[model samples]
Target: MRVLEMLLVTSCVLVLMVSLFRNTINRKIGTIAGIACGSLLAAQLLFEGYRWQMIPVYIVAALLVALLLFRRSKITKPLRFMILALSIVLLGVSVALSVLLPVFHLPKPSGGFSVGTETFHFIDADREETFTEQKGDKRELVVQVWYPAAASGRSGEKNTVFPKDRGLFHTYMQAYSGYLGLPAPALDYWKYSRANSSIHTDLHPAINPYPMVLLSHGMGVGRILHTSQAEHLASHGYIVFAIDHTYSTVVTAFPDKRVTGFLTEQSQDRLFEDSRAILHVWNEDITFVVDQLEKLHSGAVASKFKGMLDMDNIGMMGHSFGGAAAFEAVYSNPRIKAGVNMDGTLFITENRDAMKKPFMFMKSEEFTNINEKQAKYRKTPATDAELKELRLTREQFDNILANRELELKLMDRLSQQGQGRTIYIEGTGHYNFTDLQLYSPLIGLTGMTRSINGTRGAEIVNRYLLEFFNQHLRGTESKLLAGPTEDYPEVKYPNSVYQGE
Candidate 1:
């Protein structure tokens, strides 16, 4: 909570306690406490801004202060107790909301430049919507682009970091909570969250043609889920484009006021089959975005990107299912010079050996030796019924095993061809690869994800990510990639071709 918000909650409690003993103590003391709490409430509103969730608390505090100040009316004993009980309930609800929907702070970018962001919508006319068969409808996508911006010391500029659409954010949060079986109210605070990038700002002139990096989020995750990584790369002079894969993402809001939610299946076999099909769609989306970039460079699309994009130099990265898509994208499109998969299981089975460009696989501890029996046996702590509800069937496990074997085989093949590197963090989980780690410490406490410090994990991921892209895409020498330094001790290189600290 912000400072004033904390003070507001504290002062409310203090005023309530003092009101309970109005007759036992001097009436003057209760009056002064109420005045102080009222002052704090005003300060909170002035500083922290007003939220609907705190309206009840505000009303209770105001009534408490008004009643204390105007003590001419002789209050009965039962009335005093009733007022106290009501205040207590209001305060309890306010506290619960504050805890569950914390205003989380994202880690600052370590790079030298400031970041600028913009959003774009594109329709791919060549491809029809396979998920829905509405005749004559084409596939559409919403993308957020973050780029290195001209450095300015002034930080007073109004910026919309996350999606500014309240309805869209609320729908996204509702879908997320529903997917996790959490109460919708548990994520209600997300509407207030913001990002660090300034919107539609001027691009940095230091580098005319910035090397572009494409980012893809995990399945059922929003594009902004990787904002931390995107901002980091942008500050370091890379134009990052993150896509919200329509129908596969948690929620996508288009320009025409239409909102689409993710498509889910209960059958494990159908889920796997659908994943492979969706992987192809995502890969096509990447290629289509790349095509749009080419158009932007050729003055086909009127915008600041004209002649500012180095289409020949590009890299791609994704977390979870998006990671698998990145790998497939590198194989499918020669335009993608390099790719990184952050703890994603490969779903595509055919043409896995075609990848010849630079590639990196950053695995979580749970997935490091996934083909091993012990690794496969280490099931999540959820109950059997819960697992069933989550769709973790035996066939799903078999698919995971098969994907791991294929991943290992591809890594080995790429290494032999001098094009692959694999590394794993010792105490990390699948979600650790994205910005979700920075949102809440309770994520680790839930035993669903491994307990790794969020800031430190981001630093480690950012360091390697920048190094890998720098070495492959920008032709910069990276000592971190050649051989790990003592800087990040948690990263382990399991393959003989790759080195660790």
Candidate 2:
């Protein structure tokens, strides 16, 4: 919460406590406390801004204080009880809103360079939006690029982290709510949040042809969901491009006021088939975006990236479905030097072979355990009674087993080639790999995600990502990647060739 928000809540509590004992306290003392608390809250609303969620509580408190100041002697016993009860109810509602829809702050990037960001709209003319039945339609992507900016432009400049599109946040929260079955308005507070990067500022002129990294968000998530990670890479001198895969992303707001929401009607029962279909499209999305980047570099497109993109040393990273796309891109596209899969299960069954380039598989503890358990279940098939106890349908159980087996085959191939690293964080879940952890610790608190702190998780992921990209893309040896270090004890290298070396 912001400073004034905290103060307002505290003042509400004080006012409520004073009102509870209004009959016992001296009239003058009660009046002064009521006036002080009410005045503080009024000041917060007048100057600090009003949050609609808490307005009802604020009004109730203000009204109670006003009554206590003006009609202290006229207050009957039953009326005093009603006031106390109402205050308690209002306080509870206020606190609940504050906790659930918190104004979360992203952790500052711990790097040398300040970050600047810009968004570009690209139309993949050759491809059609297969997710929809629209004929002759080109697949569109909104790519947000974050890069190191010149520090000299910082004076008196407000660092606006979020894009100018107001509808984007509403769309994101609405899609997220639909996916999770939560109230859409519960996440509306995110509309006010901002990122750490500045708006389309001049690129840091000292570095030419900056190493580039492409970021892909998980399914039903927008590219901005990984803003913290993107900013971190930008702060450390890597130009990062986070792509919003049109219909696949939670929301994609185009320049022409067109908003594309996630394709939720796709096949959920046929998970693998749906995933594969989506993964294929996303892989094309990545390659197409890279082609656009080439155009930007060649001055074919009006972009600041002209002559600034180091296409030779490009890397790809993604979360969940995006991660699968990253792996597929690395396997199929020669332009991509390396890749990182942040807990994304490989959906492209054909590309199970060892990736020729360096790749890292960062897994969440829950996913790692689930995969291992599923693999074991495949070997030792559970009896009918055991299966019933597990509450998994025969098809569901078989799918889990198959997915586990596929993951093993893929990881085994990568491990054998000596270019892959498989590591999992001790206290993390699939969502920890993305910026959702940073968005709300409530996710972890409510058992919606793992217990790992979002900032710490991002820091760990960023450290490994930086090291991996630096080593492969920049030819800089990262001791952190050579072997497990004591620096991040929570990271475990399971079946990793780099382990024990």
Candidate 3:
């Protein structure tokens, strides 16, 4: 909650408490509490902005306070209790609404530099928008770049959360709510949250020619979902470029107010099948974005990045489908010095063996093993009853195991080359890799997330990302990656720890 929001909520509670004993208390004291509650409501509206969740709070509190202040007769004990109970119920609903869609801050970057970001709309005439049949429709993309910025520098700001004009936010989030199985208004308060980023600030002189990382989102997920990780990377002295893969995200809103909804949809089988080419278009998108980044640094284009990007030492990372695509990028692009894949299935099978570079595959514990929780704690295989609850038939279970084995086989082979490693985070789910985990406190109650707190999950993921990139790109090393340690008990190395070592 914002400063004034907290005070207003506290004041409302105080008023209810005092009103419960209104008859017993001195009239002066009761009146003062009522006035304070009303005053705080005005103050919250005047200072901090109001959200829809607070409406019930505002109305109920206002009416109760008005009754206390203006109504002359208070002889009926039963009537007083009814009003108080109704007010309490309304306030409780408000509290639950607030918790379900609480405005939250990104985990503060654990680095010296501040972060700044800028968005660009680019069209590649060389590649047509394949999702469309139009003859001249080119590949359009929205790229947001986050970089280390000087605190003193002047920069324009764009809020990803809670912008004053929210038409774009509504359109974007409404498209996503369907996938989340939530009502359209469930995520309405999300607009009230904001990213901890400024726009297009001068690069921090401390890290000139900062190593760059290209970030990619999962299939049907927007780049906005990865803002937390991207911001953290930028703060720690790296340039992070995240792309909203056109036609792949839930929605993409351009500065021109033209919006495009997700256009690409295919079966999982097509993703792994070579004939389908689910990754082919995405592979080109990654390569093309890098081409544009090169142009920015070429001096031909007027850009602050002209001499401030270490384009030669680039890296790529992604979540889910994006992670799979990162493999293709690093495997195909020699300029990408390192890569990380967070909980993404391998979509590029052909190039798995031929490539060798610094890479890390960050997996969630459940993705690593379905019955890991029971197996680790109780030393038993998942029972048939557990399988029923998991909704997995024995055949499906076997197939999944087979797939996981193949994945681990590749991970182990890759870990043998360069500075590659694979580790899974315990008590985390797939969305834990993205900012979606931080959306609500009740997120864990759903199957999408597990036991890990969203903030703590973000911290752990960022810590490893910084460590991995610092060692591979910046010539630094941390013992945290020199096999697992007590420092992060949640991080578990599968099979042999640090196979490359």
Candidate 4:
């Protein structure tokens, strides 16, 4: 909390204590005030709690004080009635924000992949030219591409950003601290805040172009969240380009030293519209990147990337909102031969019916036979925020079952066009598919939260992804997808072999 907020709360508490025992004012109020102030100071020092974000608690105390002040007013006792009414209203609002904001949280560490990987930092002037606002200016995004490199022990691993940006990130987190059980306004306890940098992967000369896959992230999440999956795929011979959608990511820093943080725009139409725009950006970026690789392969520039790209095969995948974007992009762009959706709420688009490419849907527990408590724990962000429109317990659980049903429907639809498949991971939550889980553990931030063991999950998913892509895109046979083997017990594919009725 801020100084002003603290003072307001302190005064309110003191006034309320005195009013509660008006008959024995002097000693009782003094003791109560002393206790309250001492507790506040102690909590601040011991737990590193924030003073500003506790506004809800403070607001309630303030109301209690105001009620007392009303009773003691010089004009009339009727003023007390008005004051009590106003305080009650204010208290209600405070509780509402506390419940709805999700202002505080301690996320579990999903962990990162231990497999080998390499990084390429590209400063795209053309990309800089593409991001134009209405005022005739362009915004450039610094994209870091992670891929598999030769087996050389000389390269070191990359790290993520920390410490310097923690204050800002913490401030932004105040918007949703309540749901996170975080220290109201201060999150100094989080291990990630001071542990490491976001730079993972080593810098080395490109090896094989490998199969290319593009990745998109959820709303308000960074592209780095997909590191576990990306690094794992790269280790197994797949080049992954994770796009950092601007203004949507919590914090995205470009090569030019410019950083654009989250800018809230809540309109559903506008949100998906932005996703579509980003999809176009991603398409153009991938096209340009492939062209660059082609040039390098042709000996145009003195480049290390030589004979490394296999442009004939490409795939795309995304999580949450990005999942919807991936579907839309595949429908609109023929370049994407395959696509996957990771527990995303389908968005409106005119092209879903026209899509002919192979697709997959991997749902969380919410998209399967799971309870709400368990469903929310999964990585899939619940799309129903409106109470009136909320799905019933049975309905919501059935939605997960429905997700599988939809997968079958889509697959049957895809078979009509020639190819399709689906896989559902049961025990995992939403963040399991992302890098944040791994990063969290490195910083000692996992605490009591549940996240997919990023390292293990990455290897499993990447192995399957590579096998799937190779079989479909490169015509390489893979027995892994033929059936569920006992080797991988964590994976439960109820629909893969049986073909859900």
TM-score on alpha carbons, each prediction: 0.84, 0.88, 0.89, 0.57
Error of 1 at 315 (Å): 0.3
lDDT of 1: 0.79
Worst 10 residues of 2 by lDDT: 155-164
Q: 3 or 4, which is superior by lDDT?
A: 3
Order of candidate numbers by TM-score, starting with the best: 3, 2, 1, 4
Candidate 2 lDDT over 30-80, as tens digits, reads 788788778777787776556766766687767867776876355678877
Candidate 4 per-residue lDDT over residues 17-136, each given as its tens digit = 454434434544555664555455445435544433355555556445334333343424455456545555664555454333322222322223233333344445544534435453
* Per-residue C-alpha lDDT of model 3 across residues 1-501, encoded as one tens digit per residue: 667766777777777677665665567876887788888888888776678888878987788678667767654678768877887788788878877768887777878888888888989989888888889999999998998887785765755543346787778668878888788787776766778888667767754588999999998878988998999989888999999889888888777989888778674333245312767888899999999999888886687788788987898999998998898889888888889999988744544765768889898977656434423423445569977996777665545445545665677777777556889999899889989888886877777778898888988999999998988888897788888888789999887422221
- Per-residue CA lDDT of candidate 1, range 1-501, in tens? 767777887887777777665655467886887788789888888777787667777888889788778777666788889988888898888877666546776777888888888889999988898878699889999998988876764333434434557776677778888876777766665656677788777777754698999999988877877888999999898999999998887788887779998774425667667777788888999999999999988899997788889998999999998998999998889899999999887777566766679999888888654445424344433357855875776667556656655656777677777788888887898888987777777778665458788888888899899999999988998888775568888888776421111
What's the TM for model 4? 0.57
Q: Which candidate is the best by TM-score?
A: 3
Candidate 3 regions exceeding 4 Å error are: 24-32, 162-164, 268-271, 274-276, 370-404, 496-501
> What lDDT is reached at residue 420 by model 2?
80
